[model samples]
Target: MTYKYQLIFLGDINNNACNTIKVRFFDKIHSIGLRDNMFEIIYNETFERKYSNKQPSFVFYFGNLNHSEKDIDILKVLLDNGDAILPIYFGDNFEAEVPKIIHVMNGRQYIADHIEKYINYAFESMRLLRENRKLFISYRRTDSSAVANQLFDAFVRNNYDVFLDTYSINPAKNFQEELHHRMTDCDVLIQLYTNDFKNSKWCNEEIISANQKQIGVVEIIWPDCTPDIHNLLCEPIQLTQKMFMNEDFHNGSCCITEECIENIVNAVESVRARNLAARQDNLVGEFVEEARKQGRQLIQEYRYLVETLKDDIIRLFIPAIGIPQSYDCFDSLRFRKLLDNEKIELFLIYDDLRIRKKWVEHLEWLNESLEVKTIKKKDFELWLKNN
Candidate 1:
């Protein structure tokens, strides 16, 4: 559903040298474990999609400085939009115009075949800059260290990036800033509930922060004690005695036994699923706003599964506004281009396909991997609601 980057190649399609560069760049991309279909080659396409959390990294590849006027304009627009650009150039045509801060790869050695290595390095750099999925531990360190340590080990073994204050904090970092970062950035917070949990200054702060940020919280009720819920934390999962090794706490040394690990896993999964749904909601709103900005009339869109194995894909249609000169406008161009740039396949409905056959053909041709369905306008609202 989300990727680390949307690798976009932006250069002069007419440049004779770029053919080898394109082939080798794609070869290297696949070789580095990046999927080819995920990458966008913006040759004749317009820049339409907004760079957001789903596609956080917007990478651009400009082959040479000998770009067309339109290509130069697009490059400027990309720079303005804050997308990362990799300008592969050898000559001094637009070198002075290029910003000193932009990411540029040397193309003089294309004959030498080292462009792929530099491209790989740039992509790796982009990936390293992305924030990793994290889980934060909120516990009373002095009282719950034993259980926290075990949970930490379990999470690590399960391949979760965890932020336990005792293990995560560094001496050189500012305590407040680092703690805030961890609390806000984490996907889930496992609150190891103890008698001292609400009393600790740090624990209380962590709970409030998690609540304010809307981060998911799993309450692991140690010794089966009820934490005072005056200041409500996020929906909590209470682990009972049957879920653990023992209810007997001879100075708080108990182990999680039977179904408790699964309980924690299920809670995390639920939170993740909810988060994914929320993200889709946000994306739907964004796509609608984008379409409206281009003055296209939205018939309907469905947020439903295209396949059980894949995440939900949106299907929307923009019909002709019924004006005589509607065909000459960027309304359709802007609408379809936005979808194409994002590689989103949706059910498109129209008054007549013959009116925009060329554009429809281009859209279908470009995204051969995507499945498209044509529907009547009468089914729009019903499809949206049911989906």
Candidate 2:
């Protein structure tokens, strides 16, 4: 998962402070289960301006009174923008310089004694925020009951919130309705395919339902039989009951070995992640299409209003079109080329109010070279109101 927070480590490399923070702090953070690539270390002050448009979640600065004015300015800006600041002052001179608005925490002391606590707290917070685990176990009870039970028990032991019809469905409830409900909500379906799996009507229905909902399916092949690839929900993971037995596991066991369980867990998690990403991409595509439709409608409405205002002398500023996009994305580059050297105002209408520093750089280039106007949706509305 992509972390929403951006952690910045600003310090002097000459004194090896940055190295200590990287090795002693951030590495341990990742090892202790926080997401990787969630932060960056910046030793140079010149590049700090690159973050002027987007605020970081937290800033850690290790320096004394001799730190550059540029670094101080960056820290001040970060603190002012509601970001947390951890300042490590080598001497007493800079202690008084820390802003009152930001809670001043000694970075060196925290790294030495309380880094693990802080890191673990952060990890727990992130886990709670991203807790969306819905697993469905699809198995042919008549053929693979033993292995299926073992897999289900293993997953429960690992604290996963999963759905197994044997465990999840109540005797009083309508079985088919409850089963469909569980399958619809599942993020990933783990299919335990035995020799007679395809012959089972219920198993085929489950697979078809999962496929129709666009949920991910992970097949655990217990039999020598291969499922028809064209009809299968997703790629099948071939695993035999003998493979588990080869590792000193027996038929009577209630659960599989830890290694086997870990492998299954990793596979399920990987497919679950893919399912989430695919859904998000589909949502973004849908949003872009709807935005384009609305933007064109608004343009047509405004154009008609302009024509009505000036009957014969209606001199529109060329025939520029506005595109709904993020500041960094200019997918209409070829379309823009079609209006080359036109007097019309080419407005890049952004989706949101917040703009990134990288986007500001892109916009600056567009303004100087292409003469395109970069405006937010709110600003465009304001222009329409005033005009």
Candidate 3:
């Protein structure tokens, strides 16, 4: 499968030349045994139509063997816009001295043999661009809206791709699904923590899901309120609430503020640098070894249970029902709207475990108390079976 990021190769080639180059490149790519889906190669002569559909971070130009100053200047322009060029020379018949800008590969075979090294460099550049390009903010509706908005504006002002709710995903049909998708896809998840946020089912779900997906979670904590740290799996960056309220919040020591947004940016950059360094140190190989050990441990522990569960379990869905005050929120009308009128088995959490009770006395009492037809778990299932 193609990754979230893609590679596009832009260079000058005639139809026959393009075919020959593609064949050579494809054979080299295959011989190196790299993943086929990781990169793409494109060649177009026209500058305007070069990358009309998708822009490439790395560009390799071939056939600039006899590099004139003009050719070097052109190569510099391509490199200036964050691209790498690999120039291929056919024969050493050049009387003119080659400029330092040209990377003189001996032949197609020489280029093919060292292709892996060039691609690795290209991939590293792509990774750095992805890591530094954007910041995504995730927040609950009830708490710290103003602060979140301010942070969003500040990040945008710094030319970061700020994906706050207003400018990010559109609130169309299946908006919740889109929200979850984006939450998982984002490089960072900025969480504004408050007591009300804990109470929100969607907010709690987002936080837990984001943590499980291994996205970076930065929590901006509220003053005078201790957040339930145990419930949050990721380590959160705790920023004082008073810091945000100050007009000089930017000047504070906290990294999230405007004046220190550079600090925050630098912190992320430092992390990227360190991570790259660790990868260079073969830390990823060590991690893989550790992961293999853990996998073996898991297989030993859950061998039978996993086999049994695989056979027995069909599907599972956990529906959320808010507190007694919002019992009406669980009415048939709302359930129908939420589930798109699909038939689903309903289970209610009773006594801290899921139960199949036909008629919940508490729900009936709630209907009587509020004079509304409160939808019990049994009622929902029965409605599903009948319809």
Candidate 4:
């Protein structure tokens, strides 16, 4: 009953994307070990009845330009209260259609299968998802460079922080060391499994490293190529000759059809969420084990860890997979109110490896003003021992 969140659907409820989002969103919640009751879905409910309070929400505003004055007013209130609202519109004249208050810099266009992109944005807004949408593309230049470049453009358009060695690595950095470091921070490894993918030294090493880290793999199997039977973490999408727009795929003109590109991108998004959840699970397990050793009793409450103490005091720990942001602090403080305990403490636990020096300094500065503190991954053992 603590820290329950809401997903509110506003404006153009009839949008096909709305219904599609609900089904997929539920799946995403389940993948992350959260129950349906932890997240309430609000649709067709009056703002006064359900959302009049200041609880944070993720709102999906659709393409319908025309909206009632009442709903518009409600949206304004939500914005003032710092609720997360996402507008989905494909048409021009976005400014003219929606009111200035509801207008965003840009809204995503609706694609049923590609709703993962929007969901990703929505979760980040709610601080349940990581701020960095990092992905690593593993493919051979000679075998699948063309298709890889096309997918890179497509993912970049969707706002993913993609790491392709040719584009992501800096000339000043060490090649092998940087490559391994880049792979460490990624949520998913999208490998273009060409005939020679396993044959390359770097490509094979990349796969080995990814599996050792237990990262999720989205395998795009090449045409006429057979995938390895091992690796339960690997989600394979076989490419037929028809999926390629270019007639000669063997000669390295691997331009995939638009539909094919969309499918692979969607697959990556789906796998990305699952991979993140798995990583979070590992973090939670490690923390729980350490807490037990320190004679601290920790219980699972929804997606967070809760430690109950005497005199109705409670400590809530939320797992932050990638970089922790300001929204994480704000959202955790908001949820602290929902618990019955008057004396409550909140913390965001995140991995500290490879985080930039400036970002860590910013987090240090940020913690001074906020009641919610962050615990770095490296300090888990010492924190457990002392606290």
Candidate 5:
């Protein structure tokens, strides 16, 4: 996807030079289907004001020997800070040689192609930098402003680029749009819940938005109240008003306090840690399931191979015996133990050779035993006849 980027062009190009650069950029942007709004161009004259206004994704400087030393120094500062600098020298001069500067030929296509590549690189770098430092805090003003202010101050003190509606964005503007943009750009959202918090549509909407965005939400509870908060949050941090007023809030310590402010900070940190752990666990579980499936498939294939070998062994060996006679080896005591273990008092069977031989002894034993008072065995046909 093509992302919007602010491009600031520096250097002292004359009227002809300016026209040439503008036409070149316009043609390139049009060719690539990019609108004028996608990029911004600034000269050295309006550099400071524009730079202070908005953060740019990429910077291009086109300078030559005719430029003043002060302008060269300013460009050097930008270059030293790792801003992408593209210089278009009027004539061949080795004096302004710098490893950071990319020499561009005075052609539309060449400038367009090089600028596009540089812009992409700059964008990717910005993305990585932004992903590393992102934090968002969500709180209801009706619940506790003091706690919210303290939390915002703590984050600011810690050098975190915190996005809390209380202080981050301009309150005078369209708040809903601003809030949506801030929440979407944030990596984590800290939610402070009070007794009356669930009743507010704005708070509920913020929570839902954070959840939908897959941003981490840490729910902090107000002191001395349990107002159906569980329905809104799976894991909420319980705290009280006294806990928030303590010195722990100032030091950025998450000591599991009952105060709302301390609890909020602690809960936010805990949720962040938990989210990281869950992501790792999910990755590990996926790998384990894949390995298990592979193992099961291997086992199935091995079993098939073994059965095939067994059939081959049987076919090669069984034919030599012509017709095999089946033999029965009975263990009376083991069979009796099995029956006793199963809690079965009697077993019925046909009048076989072994049954006939042991019939008198078995009857005598049963007559003397309390557990088994009788024993009977009959053929399937004979049992039907008797019934």
Candidate 6:
């Protein structure tokens, strides 16, 4: 079976910090409600067996290795295979602890309190979270307007490109259409789940649309309201009176405390990785399903997934969550360079749902001379039928 994500730990197996990191890693995963299929954590003991079956997607080397030559060979193989390895040290001396092979790459000095950052970067390295972060604030106006405004400010302060309907939508634009369009480009939906959230037609559809697009959701639920059942994989953060700055929740206002906002942001970061993987899976599955309808044999490989054809040609489809950027093309070019200079066609598979027409035209213009083209979700079936 093709796993969506894989993380492996190597080096200092007996370190207390490693144990601490492992415990918290699983806790973080559970806390965020990451789907079981989203990732698997392979330990040192089972490394060989697991590595034999499936290669590691990301590796955290705990540092200062006195490991056997055989294990070193395995690490070398991982490097040769282009797997991402992060050397983590605790003794302040990276060269003293990490082997010379990893010397060329930058190593991180492990901090006791920075496990969250480590895990977050691991996801980024795996292409689960794009470097540019953007989110949509989904809430019922009458129920969470105040809280929504507070979060918008907080997210903006944190350098996020957050989308709030009231502030984002222009004066003359088609409200519903523009709302839907902006949502297509957001990485996650921060839902302020109040008592009357479901009562609002637009609010209801925002959450539903987020799920349909396979975007992550961080639901901050009110004390009296039960968490919405739409996102089965998200463990909602239940709110209490203590979390409110005003110490009172009203029909149209909830000013959550600073601490609560921080927790919510962390929760969103955690969910972001898994949701990106899920979206890629959705896009790849849809494309492959379309291809199979016409009896085209496709195999899954590469960053998102790749397939080889009968004409000695390789097609690499990298899922472009939100918007496909210049970096996506550059990264794909880097990956392409790692392989033989074989006949290859690179593509960025994405959803065109509500994406701005101007950006779409820009992408089309970029495709004329650019070697890496794009395939939109809306055109998947037709793309297959014609291609």
Candidate number with greatest TM-score: 6
Candidate 1: segments with Cα more than 4 A from true spot: 1-132, 230-233, 241-246, 250-253, 279-387
| Model 1: how far residue 342 lies from native, Å | 15
Q: lDDT for every model?
A: 0.49, 0.49, 0.41, 0.70, 0.43, 0.70
TM-score of each: 0.41, 0.46, 0.37, 0.56, 0.34, 0.61
Q: Candidate 5 residues 1-387, lDDT tens each?
A: 112334556554563554555666567555533346545466677766554222323454454455524365555555333333444444456235322323321112234345544443333322222233357777666555556667776655433468777667775766776676566555457666665565678667766666554456666666555646534543566664456544332222322333444445444544543443232223222322343444411011100100012232210000000001111112222333522333323221211211223443554455475332322222222322332
Candidate 4 residue-wise lDDT, 1-387, digit = tens: 122456888777875678889888888867754447546577656666665333335777775556522267767666544445676764665665555665532456666667897776667644454236778888888888988889888877655778898898889987777777677778778888888886668766767777766566888988878876553458889888888875557856668899998777777766665565456556666887788788887754334677877886788888876567778788888656654445988988987665556667788788899999888877899987777
Worst 10 residues of 1 by lDDT: 300-309
C-alpha lDDT of candidate 1 relative to the true structure: 0.49
> What is the TM-score of candidate 5?
0.34
Question: How do the residues 4-26 of candidate 1 rate in per-residue lDDT, one tens digit apiece?
Answer: 34445555545545666667766
> What is the lDDT, from 0 to 100, of the residue 21 in candidate 1?
61
Worst 10 residues of 4 by lDDT: 48-57
Worst 10 residues of 3 by lDDT: 298-307
Worst lDDT run of 10 residues, candidate 6, spans 64-73
Better of 2 and 4 by lDDT: 4
Question: TM-score for model 4?
Answer: 0.56
lDDT value for model 5: 0.43
